[model samples]
Target: MKNSSFIRKDIFGVPVLKSEILESFKDLSHGFSTRRGGESPAPYDSLNIGIAVGDLEENVKKNRNLISGISCSERSVYLTQVHGSEILVIKNDSSIPDPDTVKADGVITDCKDLALVIQTADCQAALLYDPVKKVAGAVHSGWRGNVFDILGRTVRKMAEVFDSDPSDIRASIGPSLGPCCAEFINFRTELPEALWAYGDEKCFFDFWEISRAQLQKAGLQADRISVSGLCTKCDKDSFFSYRGSKITGRMAGFICINN
Candidate 1:
């Protein structure tokens, strides 16, 4: 029901956030990375997992490798996230290309040991796992994605592709721009009318609740979804925050089925 559902843990000197909601499933490997423990320098600081953010490609690769190693995934699929609702579904692990090749804001997969990575500086990464169908998905639901209902679309995609029931899906929203720091001055022009209700008079919006409501609307149970509620802008030292620092690195959210 709150961020208390997630815990911070150290993995090979790197700090990551793990949710208790998905911990009961031994066949699943999932975590949200902090901005610590990597090869990038300065603005990226250390654990910046996004290669398109001006960081050196070698540094990003090494950082991603560290994430893959700690996550126990064979390969981590990074995407060219454009903040849209396009969700890519992976059914095969063979012939996988290098990172940041795919163009999608979300990814669903039945392939084991292949981690779906959603890199974010302040956006929300919703991780989904349908243990019943052995399916896993990751969605980068930024403000634009919320307007498009990316998570809901991903859920329906899973149902269509993997025959996964939303009831059987367990979802988690990782650390992101919380309501406290998510101030949008032009909500009327930027956000949809329905989404306007989630904002305050001062313009700050509660995206966590927005994502939770979207998941429930997509047929997922409220109890099965966990929100980290950790604000990236507030905790800029731990996670990257573009709003806090425009020239910042991207932390990632990873999910995979154990081989």
Candidate 2:
């Protein structure tokens, strides 16, 4: 299923997953990183792109640099994702700041060569690109993000800031916790009533469908949206799953307008 929408490639020894939908655009460069081939040791084994996940800052920095190199990004913005509705809009190089100080779950930019990066272990990293407006966005949408509708907010942000029409945007939902492994036993107390309907008889929720619904609600065309259908928790050898291992490393999903 992953091969249908994505391609696996080795970049500087790191395994990166690319979306064929995004790859069709010659002006963009994007990929999702796997958890192998980096400088970090166990728990983080290698390629842990997250700095706040208790990994050594130096190792994380190297891993980040490696991913940037793999993506051909002149500059990469790694947000301190809070699973909130806030979406940072970058219109020019002047608007760029130290991303370490910026806290947001999603980021959009029209500037070329500036890669929008979202680090995740099991959360969905939704990458959106509007060829009409030449704008790109990356959002970190976990369960809390779903509650806040962060993806919808991101699409709105792109529209309000970059004049991007949701219909003209092509979006892709990357590898995350699939419904088969996403069991929420406490759904009665944790999730909202509306969200409970998306769960199965066993309390397993389909977050991928939830993301698609949110995107459609934001006015995106159904045909333009792509889902990787790769489950992180099920395929532990290829991805990092927070639910599977509490002390595991994090993978990265990146998108950039080529310079």
Candidate 3:
């Protein structure tokens, strides 16, 4: 992600992509992880959080532990990420199901100090926060999720659960597939017709703009959104890319209501 006044590097040395907009909200904490800092080795390199991938179980454990320390939450909730529009709700109350058992593409939380995480390689890990309601959401938006409008659905899901209006929510689009590398040889069969306008000289689509349009369609103001335009495929040195390599580590995007 490119640096700007809206998004700045952390002085804490976590090597994360943070949003100045989200950072300004005292009650919340959120960041997108880069491949720079952690314990995984070689291909997993460092900070590989996806457990389902071929990475060692112990390596993933250590990586997750490092993330837990960064968020300062006891544990962060993650979904199975089915690439569907299903939304998992996490209440502030004490009782909640095991997050791993929640097979959904997105998570919504009104809970404090409980981190909500999204795992991704070449897909967008979109983060949403409502300062008015002190609610947050993290979504894994792959092309399939995009076809189903997962980001927009998650916004409305927060409204259903926490009474959060999109106008009151601020968002950050984490790095993922960019237009430069989102080449689709058969977009006519793979992507919907509505998204064809963003196609580049080749068949590559600009998913970043698609995300922005989806968020705006859900009622979030243009100024309230901050997009990290970094393309995971283009920046392999900083992030994991499934398209870049079949075997690669997964980076993370995190959100929580600070205690």
Candidate 4:
């Protein structure tokens, strides 16, 4: 897959979504936001998207609305990422009513007018779309989830649930902590044995490569997948990096079926 760089500013004064790849989806409103435009205070600074991180509820709600205005539905389904392999199939009614409701790593939905949302700081946030089926999915793939091959599983689930063909699916790997900053102390124990079992004994792990590999393993066409090779830790001004700040805000990676 080839990576193209793009940037867009939201009406709310924050950098929301990338521009170069937006041309591919004419029927969807999607964006991967930065921590720049919001009403929250320090720690959460401005555009903090996570509600459970102690940011005021009102502020979080407002932030959500601002981002949603760009490319989401009136009702959006947000996942409670637990760093696991559980992928839930969401319907129109399965939204996150409160911040502490349900927990899952990935979500897939075929219902129109219902957007799929995922939150992340340093973890990988992937958006999958089947233009032929008009179905979209959002996945939060952390190191733990990657070890379990959550992306590959999510692709398979999308195929089973929406009758989507991997060849017809277009995906984007949003900003995440890259190998330059993602250093593991104990490579053998920190990562899955299976990763090392395949002879990846390097000091640092490249999540972008791992994710791209997983997408191909799921039978997705190489040209259909795109990655935003921006490293969260490397670009702190435009994104929030968990490794950069132990206590920091989250960015929203959103995808929706246009009404």
Candidate 5:
């Protein structure tokens, strides 16, 4: 959701999704990518960033180059994204492959030399930063992730690995399927009853609110959390929604600290 509501910018040509909440952090390079400004053909139409989603690998490489360039990255780390809670921690001395073969849904780093990337079509990409500890984390969270408390776990991982206190952490929930179109036909078996309260008569779930709740449980202040509030399904022109197109491109949510 790189609309006006988000900290929108045209980087060379791509519409980048940024968080105004994290904008004040002068030493961080973090933003989400929209569906525009790429070389991939229709279905992926312009800004498809995912390498395994049927798009031309060469085209994805070009888009990836643009993304890394925006952050002025020396190295970029991408996750395999299994929709699970596993997280990868990157140290300053870590040597990652070019295409990023790590298999995890969340990534955390205290090093400023590498940028962490998470690709998403409709799932929420939750970016976290602890200014006090100078640490950053990025999560690939969807309904399945929520069911396992992935956001909270990522926060805890930051604390365990980076010595970060959740109370001092600031969060940004990026564009994904909003409550308006987050319908789950078998939510009763998919989600807990407590979360069922967020469902509408039509079965739409308030994932943003759910993210907020998860943040609270992890100890972040309510005011410290920022929500993009942009629905990818509705804003199909600027975003990629898996449910909207079934075979659409993925938006990139990237975060990195500055040296």
Candidate 6:
């Protein structure tokens, strides 16, 4: 499967969805949204997918609809994204509740025609799919979530829920603040011990590396995984970055079924 790219513009004339990886999975619809599309104004600019970010509810709804159109899902399921390691199993009924009502960094679902969504600015957004089992999962992995191996946990949850095998799983690591731009302070405490446990001080803390390592540990083949090396903080025009702009809007990473 060769990697390709595509851009989907929001109704408001913003390039809301863009994908650099996972282009091979044309049967499945997925994209990473930008902040250029929507109805929000000022602080939120136009497209702010985050409802709790002080953006108006109506604008958030519109932005969501735009995303849903690109993903080809009726509606996208949002996660509370507490930066924790919690992984939740999602069913058809699971989409009814608001994101605030649920707490999880990752969610997995086998239900057809449902979209799995995750919000991120500087944090890593991971999308996983097992074509064989027809299972999908979305993960929001911030530094805290990475420390606890949330990606692996999510894959394990998928295995339990859909009897998915990691080897059959295809994964895409969406844009985020790359290691070159993702610096940390007070690393002694802010970061977990497992990071230093491997004795790679020169390596610093690369979320991409951590994510890839975790995915491999979960059994996904090296060829099945793709990483978007784009750094949100570095590419101001293409993505929204919390570290690049503290009060910036959030970008969404979504995966869904065409049915």
Q: Whole-model Cα lDDT per candidate?
A: 0.90, 0.90, 0.86, 0.80, 0.87, 0.78
**Structure candidate 2, residue pairs in collision:** none
Q: What is the TM-score of each candidate against the true structure?
A: 0.96, 0.96, 0.96, 0.90, 0.95, 0.88
Model 5 agreement with the true structure over 88-134: per-residue lDDT tens digits: 88766775644456678988888886788889989999999999999
Please give the RMSD to the true structure for each candidate, in Å: 1.8, 1.2, 1.5, 2.8, 1.7, 3.3
Q: Pairs clashing in candidate 4?
A: none
| Residue 190 C-alpha lDDT in model 3 | 83
Off by over 4 Å in 5: 1-5, 97-101
Write the residue-wise lDDT of candidate 1 on 91-135 in tens digits.
865466554566789889899888888889899988999999999
Once superposed on the true structure, which residue ranges of model 2 sit more than 4 Å away at CA?
none
Quote the lDDT for 164 in model 4: 90
Q: Model 4, 1-259: lDDT tens per residue?
A: 1234555655546667663554467788777888887888888877887988888999998888877676647877777889999888875565444425667888888777777788999999999888888778889998887898999999999899888999888888788988787777686877876565433445677878888888999988887777788889888877888999878889988888886
Please identify model 3 stretches exceeding 4 Å from their true place: 5-12
Q: State the lDDT of candidate 6 residue by residue for 1-259, as single tens digits.
A: 1124434545336564445445566667777777676677877776688878877888888888878877777866898888998887876565456767889889888777788889999898998888887788999998888788898998888888788988999888777878777666556788776675433455445778878888999999987777777788887766778887788778888888555
Candidate 2's residue-wise lDDT over 1-259, tens digit each? 3668788888887888888889899999998888888899888978898877799999998998998898898689989988788888888856787887888999999999999999998999999999998999999999999999999999999999889999999999888999999999998887889898899998999999999999999999998899899999898887889998889888989999997
Instruction: Flag the better candidate by TM-score, 1 or 5.
Output: 1
Kindly list the per-residue Cα lDDT of model 3 for residues 52-157, writing each as its tens digit: 8888999999888878878878868978888888898878775667866778998888888888889999999989999998889999998888889999999999
How many clashing pairs per prediction, in order?
Answer: 0, 0, 0, 0, 1, 0
- State residue 182's C-alpha deviation in candidate 5, in Å: 0.5
Per-residue lDDT value at 134 in model 5: 95
**TM-score quality measure for candidate 5:** 0.95
